[model samples]
Target: MEIVIINSSPRKNGNTAQLCDAFIKGAMQTLPKPKVTTVFLNDLKFKGCQSCFACKLKDSKRYGKCSLNDELSPILSAVNKADCLVLASPIYLMDVNSSAKAFLERLCFSLGSYEVGYRSLAPKEVIVVTIYTMNTTIEYSPVGAMDNVDAFLGHIFSTPRRLCAYNTYQFQDYSKYVVDVFDETEKLKYRDKEFPKDLLRAYDLGRDIATRL
Candidate 1:
């Protein structure tokens, strides 16, 4: 089995990446372990779908696949063939970061058909999971911020199971940054207390999903 993880956060060792690691660790412990691939979007050079409509053409050889030939092409292909997919990103401006947004646009648009029902042309129904890390508290988060993205993924694959870490610690030494919006003491306390729980939850989510599959 193939499990693909997309890390859209620019910080490779940040909270978002840590959660992805935890998930992978749990998945690797399962019986009959699956092959896992982690792709860091920040390390790739790519853009969103170009609206070329090549994937929609009935007679096109690339129908139901993204035709963009770039660093993201092979990653998209792998996602299409994956048994499970995990998208991890840090929320920026109340939504997923730019890399995640761009990746989703290409992946979802290509697999979505322009048929009467707007059906999905995906090769298979892959299990989907989304992990979000943000500085905003859960109560202050924008409602329905990810509804549209989730809808697209759900149509193309399975409805995604969501995991979130809110009010995350943003800086290692808050003194270095010129930000005073948040209390550094509180942030540290929360990170020391709650972040570990989030990691544990991520691990549980991965193991449960892998075992069930």
Candidate 2:
């Protein structure tokens, strides 16, 4: 089977990318021969959905497909062919990153309209990965962002299988708060210490999806 991973982190090799890599690694170990492709959004040039509704035109053969000719066409084509899809991004301001949001808007606008007729084109399973620098103790900090992704997946995928989110707290700028005990460098150290644990969870999520597939 084939799996496609869309990485939307602006920072190359950042926490989000690391988690995605770990997940891919685990998936590879499980399947041993599954074809996996990772697409980085930073390298692509694509605009957000314009809400033209042209994709749904009765005469349009490319309905539910973006008319704008750009780099995203190939990526979307890959998504259409993949058996499973993984969306990985770093949370910005408690939501998806701008690139990730733009990609979703385009995908939703293009694919949402034709979902019924083109059900087979949709990915059978979807996995979401979100990385943040917020405190992990906050009950709602991570789930808040993950819920948004889950809702998005529910709209796009007919059989959305699983969702996974990983959050790293105290990773940066811990000194801003007066009551905080960890400093910026200390927060970085903590992240370094906790990286393995975070990666292990991500790996498990990947393996779980592979098993279901």
Candidate 3:
């Protein structure tokens, strides 16, 4: 199986990246020598869709490709070849970061239009998994955090399987900072106890997705 993971977290070893790493660990177990690729969105120099309509223009051969000759082109090419696409991102103010959102726009919008409805030029059978890490618990997350997005992406690929790690560790050393609101002890509890469960689930989910493919 070919899997491509786009990690949008700037923190290279943060919770979101850890989950992606765990997922890849289990996925490789399912398929020997799986072709897995991970792209950190922060490392790329790219921009949101410019609304150039090059993709939509008549006689344009780049219908399914973005014309911007930048860092995202190769990533999109990888997606074109991938059997499974995994998006790992830390929640920023209840949504994906700017890079993820921009990549998504180019990935989906350039290939198709909203009036024509959302679509992807990627394979029809490509599986999708999205992992979200946030500081708030699932119970407290805004209603729109993951809602509608599943279905929207489902329109482009398949109905995406999702993973969430809530109440995450936000700092390397809580004592170093003077943020008074969060109880460091309780944060440690969620970090040491709860977050591991999310990693385990992520591992299992990788295997599950791979097996399904």
Candidate 4:
């Protein structure tokens, strides 16, 4: 299966990446040797959607292509070819981080346009998901609203799957940072006792997607 993981966490080994790693491990264990491709959005050089009408130009073959010729071009191509695609990112403010949001915008413009009416460009049977990791607890109102972002993703990538991690680790060394909103002690306790379970769930989802492939 051609599984593509777009990781938007700027931290290389942050909580989001850990969850993604578990998913990849599970997918890798599947038959025929799963070819897992991971793209770290922070490592790429690209801008957000430019709102240009080039893709909408009449008789233009570039209707489904981002005009920018940068690092994200190939990644978008991978999304088009993917049998299963995962959009994983850390929640910033009330939604996905900037990099992730930008990627989605470009994808939206590339895959479909209002001029042509909205349409999906992904494989009909593609298994797609959006995984979110947040410092706030799952019950947090905005965090709960995170699933709303999937309205578009689900429309583009088929009915999607999701893996959410709440009360995620925020700092590698909490002592070095001036932060007092959350009790680090309780967060660590939760991570030690609960995060593994979330990872396990992620593993299961990965295995399931691979199995479908």
The best candidate in terms of lDDT: 1
- For each candidate in turn, the TM-score is 0.97, 0.78, 0.94, 0.93
Writing each residue's lDDT as its tens digit, candidate 2 over 47-87 gives 87777787778867777677777898788777766777777
For model 1, give the RMSD to the true fold.
Answer: 1.1
- In model 4, what lDDT does residue 153 have? 75
- Rank list by TM-score: 1, 3, 4, 2
Best of the two (1, 3) by TM-score: 1
Cα displacement (angstroms), candidate 3, residue 163, comes to 0.3
Clashes of each: 0, 0, 0, 0
Between candidates 1 and 3, name the one with more favorable lDDT.
Answer: 1
How do the residues 29-64 of candidate 4 rate in per-residue lDDT, one tens digit apiece? 775488889999999999888988677776787766
Name the lDDT value of residue 145 in candidate 4.
Answer: 50
The residue-by-residue lDDT of candidate 1 on 1-213, one tens digit each, is 899999999999999999999998888778356899999999999999899988888888989888899999999999999999999989899889899999999999999998989999999999999899999999976447667777888999999988989999888899999987899988899999999999999998888878856
Candidate 2 lDDT at 69 equals: 70
Model 2: what TM-score? 0.78
Better of 3 and 4 by TM-score: 3
Question: Would you list the rank order by lDDT, best first?
Answer: 1, 3, 4, 2
